[model samples]
Target chain A: MSDFLMFSLVPMTVAIVICMSCALLGNFLVLRRQSLIGDAISHVALPGIVASFLLTGTLASSAMMLGAGVSALFTVAMIELIRRLGRVENSAAMGVVFTSLFALGVLMLEWNEVGTVHLDVEHALYGNLESLIWFEGTSLAALVDPRALSDLPPQLARVAWMGALVVAFVVAFRRSLVLASFDADFAASVGARPTLVGLLLVVMVAVAAIAAFEAVGAIIVIAMFICPAAAARLMTDRLASQVALSQLIAVASAVLGYVLAGYGPGWMGLGVSLSAAGMIATLSGGFLLLACLFGPHRHRREALST
Target chain B: MEAWWRALIFDAGYNTSLVTLGAMLLGGGAGMIGSFVLLRKRSLVSDAISHATLPGLALAFILMALVFGDGRWMPGLLVGAGLSAAVGLWAVQAISHRTRLGEDAAIGAVLSTFFGLGVVLLTVIQSMAVSGQAGLTGYLVGSTAGMLAAEAQLIALCSLLLAAGIFVMRRDFLMVCFDPVFASTNGVRVQRVDMLLMLLLLAVVVIGLRITGLILIVALTIIPPVTGRFWTDRPLRVVALAALLGALAGYLGVTLSSVREGLPTGPLVVLACFVLFLVSFLLSPRRGILATLMAHQRFKRRVHLRQGLLAMARDEAIFDDLTMRVLRRQGFIRRDGVATPSGWAAARDAEHEERLWALYRQYYPEESAQLDHRGLLPIERVLSPDTIMVLENRLMMGRGAHP
Candidate 1:
């Protein structure tokens, strides 16, 4: 039990927080027809972190976060510039920018031998989720002890704040965000700044991605950013309820996925642990698949246009 | 430096030359097929397709290790990658069609989930303690440090087939990508052609995996096609230019990576593609940035010069600095802001043209609306000589009526 407490508890909670923040902002992205921006940002995050490490010569959380944030904004600008100036499609523009930047990141990673510093392509993909153990918090009582709480993995606190920030942003701009997402032209005519809302939403997504990236890796970050919200989208047409359901789905996926990854193999006599981050992503994808098949609103059958 | 030069010209040994040549061919094929993918608005689908190959790769590794005692068979893995990528494309199609989610959403879902499954399987393989798994990671970023003759030949032959297939079906691809509805009406099997094109694209993705890696291959295909767009508007020219650019990038990038000790092949190849894209983006005569800016400047001068001439004809005080400078530069006005002899002649023509326009507008409102703006273009350019004469008579009558 102490082993579980020392190892799994903090990582699992951190995973839940990461999922919450990602799912919260995903509501806006999925509705606005920009789900792939999450993929692009996460892809570019590898480069951003590498560039930051190269510049700052440290892997401090703040530095990495700032680097990722700057790169995310850069990617947005690059995609916009290419699309507008080159007259390319939006998706194609995104593909070009993210892949080029990602290649730059990979080249930098290989050239500089960041391997000793715990930076590699595999780490960027799956992350160090399994090793984010809370050594000081060995027992259940340690959860309440101030010293142990203080010693908890710093990622937990960062992800928690990001979760709050995302929830607050969603609650504050619920109406206009929905208006802009559902019908940008109508929203613009009605005196709302759809572009401004869209920009703010993208910033929130970048922040959430950075917050989750260190814990769950880019793949899970993308899965969290899309799967829960997409599954919830199939369940309900109401945007608010959809957001609520996605949060629930995200939390459930995190807890269940963490448990299954840690203990499922033991129960099956394999006697080896699996990756929590990958398991979480896989479970969330399963949730989405299930929703796609059976969710009440999956077909949108009530629409007369059909 | 001599070694670098030798590598540049592909004077490297037989094995190195084989790899370099294979990479160049693969690049050409990717660009050829990628041009069609871009025209069809399915460029991002390549990213999803590449990422989704992971699960199949891991599964193939497991199967091979279990049966053959070696999981490093390139053919087995490429086949596996192709199958999974096809499944990924199908999933994207189904999700977008069956659910309310857009294609972008489907791409995100399929890629992340499939990669997740691959990662999970990879961890399982790690726990199994498989040997010779180091090369498996090479598929991610690609390495040319150790070249095999068979692998190079396989890549070369596959690329040749891919390019030939594209060459044979070029018209069908162009017709389908440009206008599926039109092609279908003209008796083309739109769906079949689209499927065949996708199969060709899958081959490009699978074969390019060793040279450009799966992740960077998206840029390999997409950047060249976009670069090709900068050069020309003709569809066939765009296709040809893209293939040439891709081949150059691939050939140059592989050679350069071979010159260095630590440099990886995939990223260098992508960077080469990006350089080509950047150069064409800034330098092309028609769609490039410099040309667009030059055209805008030329149009601005015409507007300013025309407006200045009209103001001089009407004796209106011209306060716009651009108009003043334009008029002064063209000798339409003196340094002291008075009209010169040639300036007066030009102003008289302009004044007469303005009157002609006013009469033309009053007589033919519909046609006047269709003309480019109002005053910049001369009346003779748009109307026939008979129409100009009629307009000139109307101008004289209007002046007489007013005077």
Candidate 2:
């Protein structure tokens, strides 16, 4: 029972935290038509994580966070530069820059005498969420004991901070973010610097992405950044309700995905635990599909209303 | 240099050469089909479709294992990829056409969701204890180093079919791209033409998926045509140039990967295409960055010179010395800084343009403020239909102050 709680319950909490944080910020990304930046940033963050390992010789959180921050800023600047200089479309520029960065990360990992270390491209692509166990004080009794709170895994703590940072950022800049997302010129006229607000939002996204990278992997990070928010958007028209709906969906996906990933294989006679990150992403996709077909604002109804 | 030449020609191993040839063919076919896709403004739609193939591929693998007692055939996998990609494209079209979500949102939704589903399937496949299951990861990040000659031959055959199909239907494709409403009115099957192009896109994507991987395969289709666009405007020339660029990227990317020890082949090819794109963006004679900058500078210089001439013609005290020299050199002014006859005529034209600009500023404060004084003069060469109509009405009213 302790093993079950340690393995299943703790990871589910971590997944929920990661999902809610990503989905909250994603609501604005979808509103601003910059949903793909999530995809671009997560892919580009691979080299950041790898570089952090090479520099520190350990997978330290602060170093990796700093690396991810630098890499995200660099990716944004490069995408803008490519778009301006090459006159390429925004999506094409994103595709080119992020893929090159990811390839560079792969090459670096290969050059660094790969298999001796814990990091690998495969791991980065699909994370090892199952390894995030409560090893410090593994007991169901730890849950009720206030002293045992400190025994929480470091990754869980990091995600908790990430969640706090996301909430703080949204609260601090909610008005500016909303105005900038809807009308930049109006935002500017109203003393809300859209560019600064955008930068702050991107910083939060980078933090969230890097924090979740070890727990959820790059693909799930991208999927959470888009699918939950998009599904919520289809369900509502107001931004506030949309954000609420997105968080609800995200938490539900995390819980459902974690349970299914743990138990679904056993039921099917495979006798193997699958990847929680992949299952969460898949479940989020399922939610998006359902929302598209049967949500309050179905496509045809949206069209007619508009 | 000699070694480089040898490798470039025929000295690379048979597998290397075969892979390179296959890449080149795939690139050419994607380039041609991508032209239509780009024209349709569905560049990102192709990305969503490629990602959507993952679920289909996994599904095919499982079904083959369960039903047919075999799961690793190349054709079966590709068939699954193609079917799923078609569904993805159809979803994109349906959502964008039917909903207020717009194309970008629809694309993001479909891309992430389909890929997420695929990732889930992959996890399931990994736990099934199937032998050779690890190879499925190759589709995510392609491994061209281990491409077999038989697979290369298949790529070549499919590429050839794609090329022939596009070649025969070139006219119809062009017509549809240029104006679908007109084509439909002319009794051309526009939808059929569109479906044909989508079919070709699926073919190219499935083959290129092996060579470039799913993550970067869209680049093979998108980058080449955008590069071609910088150098030409003619439809045939754009297609030809795109095909050439794609072939070059394939050849160079493959060679680079072969020479380097651990470099990924797909991204290397994509980088090669990007390098070419950057070159064309900066150096193309007509639409290049350098050309645009030069044109802007030349326009600025002309504006300064004309402003000087106008000042001299008006006898304004703010006239500069360089303006006087340029006006004198052009015989627009005498040595005494007096306007000559030809100078007066030119100055009148310049003054008229200024008046037009002044008039333009009243109506569009922001737009006219952004323009230089001479910006409106170019419009005199080919008057806008609205402007022409306005001028005719003014003339009828006997207000003879022509701009």
Candidate 3:
């Protein structure tokens, strides 16, 4: 039983951490009218992940995160450039840039024969969250022990690091971020460089996305960024509460999704465990639907309040 | 390389030729329909709709498998996809209308949520015991190598209908896209036209699913029209050019993928479109980046040269030899480094213009006025003689300066 608890503990914690951090940043994105940027960055991260693996020939988390960060920034830059030079709408620009980059990533993966047993297109697309195991005993003492600590899943540590970084960024820059989102020109008039704040926000979101890519897959990360945050937006009328509520929703969905993925099929007599990431995405999407349909708050609040 | 060359020339095999032709047909249709979608700024809606089709496709397959013991019928699956896409489109509209969220958020929410549902359905299908389920997976990334001649025929037929439909209502599509309110005032039934366009877009997406897959199929519609916009502004020409570019990209991508054993066709096709877009972005005559930059540089240089001439006119500076040469070459100066008759007239005119601007700036600073650098607009030309007299009187009173 302890072994079972140990096996599921790391994946569950990582899932919750990934969801919570993404949901927190996602509220800002939804408020700023840039929610889709998270989806674009996650899609573009595929190329970054593949390029990192190719260049370093290792799946080291740092290399992957760095590569994904570069790729996400490049994607953002390319989208802006396309919108300017091509005179295309921003959405079309995003569609063109990320799809082509994703395509390029796939081609590179095939050409380099990077589809080894450990890393392949399927793993990149769907992820292998099941293998996020820790050899530590299921106890607080074991967690503190250096040997047991060393045996922990590396993805959990990365998630924790990103979670802390995201939290610090939000706490320090909340006022400026809110000002920028509400009215950038007004923010500028008040001696706040809205452009810098906006850039920092995107960079932070990209960082969180790159960190979560290995554990939850790109698709689920997109879900975490949009669904819970959107649902939270429906539930509340304040930015701080939206952020906190989104994190709560994300944690609940993670817990529910993990349990359902593990045991729901047995209850249905299907005797097959489904993909945990997909289950989490579905559950978060369900939260969004419920919020859309039945959230008690119906009065439209001021736009920036979210 | 030789194999690639052979494939490019249709010497690979009959199957290769058929698949390439099918891809081209699908690309042409998607490109044409995508022009309207891009112009209408509904590209994101199309994205949500396409993603929504995945779950519908899976549901269709599941239902057909359980009911008829055969789920591989292409038409039934497409009908399912179309229905689901319509639902997704309706959801996007409803969300933006019913909630405080903007359209972008609605698009993002619907896109991710529907795609998430599709993923769940996909896993469910994979776990089920069913035959003919293998081909369903190809709808995710698309496999051009697995395309059949029958499917190619369907794509060709759809392309024919798409071309004809676009030809019939090109004017209505144009009017509604540019000015829906004006079109409505003219009794053009804008909503019906939008519905027709939506139907056509759905058809293109359905055909494209077999060629490019769900995730990247929106690219076929978006990239071509955007690329075409670089070349022209005429609606029909843009649509025609987009169709041509789309076909070219489709042909080349399939040729390359056929030559390489492991290359995925859908993304390769998108990459090909992107390369074309990149070329057009850099080199197209009208809206290309290079042309815009050149025009900007030319304007800057002209401004610099004009500033030099203006200073010389005021007797505050003299031209360098290089400046004189350039001015002489452009017939703005003479060979002896002195002003010609026209140049002298221009110099006096420039000096007079400067005084007038200075008078206006000093006296009427409250009313921001812009100077027209291209033309020597004397105050008399822009204002009536009586108004100029009044302005001169006011200026003399206000500034204690003479013009």
Writing each residue's lDDT as its tens digit, candidate 1 over B94-211 gives 8888999888888899888888888887887787766868777877888877757899999999998888889889998999999999999999999999989888888899898888
All candidates: interface RMSD: 1.2, 2.4, 1.8
Q: What is the lDDT of residue A290 in candidate 1?
A: 95
Predicted candidate 3 versus true structure: per-residue lDDT over B256-319, tens digit per residue: 9887776778888989999999999999989899998998877766665566568668666454
Which candidate should be chosen as best, given lDDT against the real structure?
A: 1
Tens digit per residue, CA lDDT, model 1, A112-217: 9997889999999888788878888788899789998888888888888988998899889887898999999999999888999999998998898887887779
Error (Å) of candidate 2 at residue B117 is 2.6
Best by DockQ: 1
Measured against the true structure, the TM-scores of the candidates, in listed sequence, are 0.97, 0.84, 0.89
Q: What is the lDDT of residue A163 in candidate 2?
A: 93
Per-residue lDDT tens digits of candidate 3, residues A237-279?
7777888889989999889988898788889998777778878
- Model 3 clash pairs are none
Ranking by TM-score: 1, 3, 2
Top candidate, metric TM-score:
1
Sorted into a CAPRI-style docking class, model 3 comes out as medium
What overall lDDT goes with each candidate model?
0.87, 0.79, 0.81
Residue range with the least summed lDDT across 10 consecutive positions in model 3 chain A: A297-306
Find the 10 residues in a row with the least total lDDT in model 2 chain B: B394-403
Pick out the ten consecutive residues of candidate 1 chain B with the lowest summed lDDT.
B373-382
**Which portions of model 3 show Cα errors greater than 4 Å?**
A138-141, A298-306, B9-11, B65-72, B131-134, B317-349, B352-403
